[model samples]
Target: MGRHVFLRIVDVVSNFDPYFQQRFDAVRRKGLSHLQKCTAAMCMLAYGISADDVDDYVRIGESTAVEALKKFVSNINTLFEGEYLRKPNENDVQRLLQMGEARDFPGMMGSIDCMHWQWKNCPKAWKGMFMSGHKGVATIILEAVASSDLWI
Candidate 1:
């Protein structure tokens, strides 16, 4: 089951740009390969696996799993800043609005929604940020443009 899940994740990530692979290569030279660390971190994040349970799931030491999770987050933040998550200019916003209008949905600059994600072990200091609606453990914000047909 673990192997199947890991392979499925690999398939999904493989479709992303090669930037992630290149960054992984650089990180791999320092000792732990990116695949190992990323797989462990993703397992925890996606499957709600506790830090203690990661060892049983991924065959790594508990300490190593913790370190991998930390490194995964740090590396992702660095790469996100480098590759994506840019500040949009006025022109870009206007272009997006125009595109939305072209699709017959004027005045709909964008759509906003939130998804609830389970939080396994949130810290007390950061619980508020992760709070969600009833039966929701955590939330993630999502925004995208909608077309006249309600397609996004």
Candidate 2:
């Protein structure tokens, strides 16, 4: 991510949970910047990387990276659960059915789909998780359900 976008994410995260704020620890150098912590956490989650793997790139310790991951998940659950992660209700289902009809997919309330991606740079031990075939390349597949009105 670009510096601006990363900073924007750190800003949002810090606003949601002040634990991401930059601060000095008791006996060490000043703590990692919120940007570093957030970036490390994002990398670990996005790539399913081990905490130790983020140390060199993000200049964070393994333990701190893990801590950041835990806190980041907690804060996201706390801050955004209500609006973005909510389940669709009856009205949303009705609207989706209408949209499907207009789109010539009658009776379909929502669409379900999946995407497969190669994980070429994945770490050796982690490749098994994404390995789905004998191609010797790791891969991941993402599945989602959504409609014109909501992701549900």
Candidate 3:
């Protein structure tokens, strides 16, 4: 990975505790450190790379790629709840609005957009959910903030 990209990711995730550490400590009575697994998953998500590409790019086995992806999704799901779908509260939304107003973009609670990404060799069964934008390619769903510029 490029130094800038690595540093940026480190900055994003450095404050959050890894879910695996808590689980490992509780169950095994010892922490299981798999920095490779965490880094591979982060790289794949951040870059929107496929598992096979991540395996090759990160120099890890394909099995590790699959496991990392699974663990990443599982851990994230555990942190979210309810029908609002992990949205910020009223106070947080107000703060964001104030921030946007200060930045001269008012009335923007948030910005929503989508992108179509090419998915070569996609399985037939999963094509429907991924199609978008003149059917050009598979689409990965993304949502982000306009003020803070955070991806969710």
Candidate 4:
């Protein structure tokens, strides 16, 4: 993400939730900054890493990282639900259908696709369940339907 966009998100989230604000520990030493908390949350989201994994990079413990991520997501949803995360309305559906038809995809509202990503940290117990038979590697499948305008 661009720096401006990231900073904008950080600002909005920090304003919405005091949890993102910097605080001092019992020893009066400053705890994590807003940047650190937001970075920890963003790293887990962008990399799909476990909360524990962000500890090494973001210097946040697993539980704290998880808390930050949850609060971040909740704050974003609450703050931007109407503008950025709304369900498609009738007009949106019609527009999507029209766009699809214009591209010769009659009756299609959007294009659907799926990709498999190797699960680098797949648990040993579930490895076999997610393993691809041909490639013999554990993977997770991600699927999305996006309009021609790239709205997913």
lDDT of 3: 0.62
Cα RMSD (angstroms) for every candidate in the order listed? 7.1, 4.1, 6.4, 3.0
Give the candidates in order of TM-score, highest first.
Answer: 4, 2, 1, 3
lDDT of 2: 0.83
Q: Give TM-scores for every candidate, taking all chains together and pairing residue i with residue i.
A: 0.58, 0.70, 0.53, 0.74
Using lDDT, give the best candidate's number.
4
lDDT of 3 by residue, 1-152 (tens): 78786555444343344543423544567443355566778777767677778766667677767776787656555543442247787876888788778878896666766655566656889888778765667766554555565523
- lDDT per residue as tens, model 1, 4-104: 86665444443342322424345465444446556778888778687778777667678878876776666556545543446656765687678779878
Better of 1 and 2 by lDDT: 2
Model 2 lDDT tens row, 68-131: 9999988878767776667767887788888999999999988798877777678899987878
Q: What clash pairs does model 4 have?
A: none
Q: What is the per-residue lDDT of model 4 for residues 46-126, given as tens digits with 9 covering 90 to 100?
A: 888999889899898999999999999999999999877888889989999899899998889998999888877778999
Candidate with top TM-score is 4
Which ten residues in a row are the worst by lDDT in model 1? 15-24
Report how far off residue 56 is in candidate 2 (Å): 0.5
Report lDDT (Cα) of residue 137, candidate 2: 75
